[model samples]
Target: MNTRGQFLSSRLVNDSLISLFVVSTFPPFRISFQLRMWDWFQQYCPWVLQGISMVYGMIVRIRRKAYQREWLRPKHLSRPVVSVGNITVGGTGKTPFVIWLAHQLHAKGQRVAILSRGYGRQDPSKNLMVSDGKGHVKEWRVSGDEPTMIAQHCPWALVAVGPDRFRLGQWVLEQTPCDCFILDDGYQHLSLYRDLDLLLFDATDVKGLCGVLPAGRLREPLDSAKGAAAFIFTRSETLSSIQPVQTCIEKVIGQSINPIVLKMVPKQVRHLVTGEVQPLTFFSQRSLLVVSGIGNPRSFCDILTGCGLEVGEEIRFPDHCAYGQDEANLILEKIGQSDQDIVVTTEKDAVKLREWFSKDDPVWFVTTDLEFLAGEEHILGLLDRAGVV
Candidate 1:
């Protein structure tokens, strides 16, 4: 119609296009900036973080006390639930340990079902059955990466995901025959009563055990660890490496407790597309373009280096990162720049990246296993005593 009207419409369209471009392109930079700012705040503004942590700690204490005093009652399923969790916000090799435990119970002829909150999943369903004792029923995005990986490893075990694990367990029991349940990341989940709670700690991160929430990595006070039936020190390089953490925990719990020590060793490398298994020695001394979106990228890299692989470049994304075409393109660019290096990632990341990368891509994932350095018999005996087996 009018010239002014046309001018205004063109301007509006241009502005909208520019806004969309910025919104789409700014996320990676925004996430990086936010993480840096958070780290800076944690370091330089201790008083502020300490104040927030104090408030958070009070809430945690109140909720725990309510559960203990029966102000809030925990619901239990017909089958016993064995919880595998860590106090810290990051990884302590829980997936591998859960897979190991599931295999152990499965070998004993127990029908195991894994219950998880399915953190970072996009699905809004109340309860999603990830696997039905045979294979995955839902994709990784719907079931979350960790649960998908667990289901992939433990095909015979049923995996269910939902916020309310008690309801999820009930749903599983109603549908299938499950002898017991394995609660993943259930240390803070107080609504469901667990027959055995195994608390995990990263032995390498002893300093992270100092405070709660914003002040440190701990989800609750060190004293809360006493509620666990047993403690497990994961990524244990040696007894000396774990002694500091054990001492700190024992002092807070006001007693000495036996801790199971586990070393997460790389067992094999598997091709993500072809399902071809390769030994660790297959890639020894070769250059790798390491890509990971996990809580413990340093640990994963260390395992790679320990196996004699040179990390040519590393692309670290935030934990449980939902990979898309942008990430796939970035990874390909990095790989292209590297000098004949193979691409490597963690199993958790591989679950999502498999859809992004092709079958012909030189992408491999490291599969790790829990090697119990100590207290193996103690854990097995605890499982037996709890009637899990």
Candidate 2:
């Protein structure tokens, strides 16, 4: 599909309430008449588009069946591979969770390696490894927003990207004696058998989604949650009322898997220019302009409002949106027309913005992390039992 076509199609598939169940979050884009569209689409054309998408989806399922039938056995590397991913598409805070897991493993003296697909990379290569900045050059493109963020944030661990993570895992094991290989966003990549699977679900958007692919956001049905070793409800804040939310999720999945609920809250806001970290409290006293182009922009806007920031205006864009010069100019022009003073964006957008846009250009980026709540220890215990640490 062309870029605009891709965006529109993606928006339709992702905008449904069921999309929330699959991905960890919702589509950040908001249509002008979203409610009316939802009412109409849900009432009429849901089956038509969903049926079309399911044709593409069924092809994928058959491909998965090929693997299951032993036609595509993934090679087993020397070390155990633990995959951190979600069944649905979009952000599940996989980067942050990987970072957190690596640190936890590192504290126990276990070496870890990460493998990714490196989506949106400029270079074209099937087998590639990220560089370690030493005299030695590692093979792949360190270009995707999430991979770059992972590389920079976790320098101690080795990071690589390839379409075939099973191959990448084998290569990394040959290069380094890593104890564990962490597969980033490889839940559906069935060639490799993972030691543990963490499926992240966004709490806010699950209400409207009721069915399977194309008709809703689910890459697979909600029943796929049963396949995961553990389910992580990411970005669930106090405002989300996670307990009842967790109960609802368990009910939907049908097995009552007793998955752990992890709550992630924005604890601090950073000045992109000075690199100063300030308490999140400062947002309460400010009139803010929230800017984000991610899978779930409404959640970020809700976060700001939840934190007591007077969210004057919110700008949303398609997921993985590459802000161009024209778009930047338009944003600056809009800002000039508005009386709202401060600007804030999520950390994921901040990385993309840094490439072309900057905080010095009168934009302030607010970076947040997935902070696990009391259930953090319970999860750690599970990992411990699994010998992950």
Which lDDT values do the candidates have, in the order given?
Answer: 0.82, 0.65
- Prediction-by-prediction clash tally: 0, 8
List the candidates' TM-scores in order: 0.90, 0.81
TM-score of 1: 0.90
- Backbone collision tally, model 2: 8
Q: Which residue pairs show collisions in model 1?
A: none
Question: Model 1: per-residue lDDT, tens digit, 259-355?
Answer: 8999988889999888899998888768888877777767887788877877766766667778887777777776676674688899899899888
lDDT of 2 at 4: 19
Across residues 288-362, which tens digit of lDDT does each residue of candidate 2 receive? 766676666667766777777787765555566555555455456657768766778888767666545564666
In model 1, the worst 10-residue window by lDDT is: 2-11
Error of 2 at 320 (Å): 1.9
For residue 348, model 2's alpha carbon misses the true position, in angstroms, by: 1.4
Query: What is the TM-score of candidate 2?
Result: 0.81
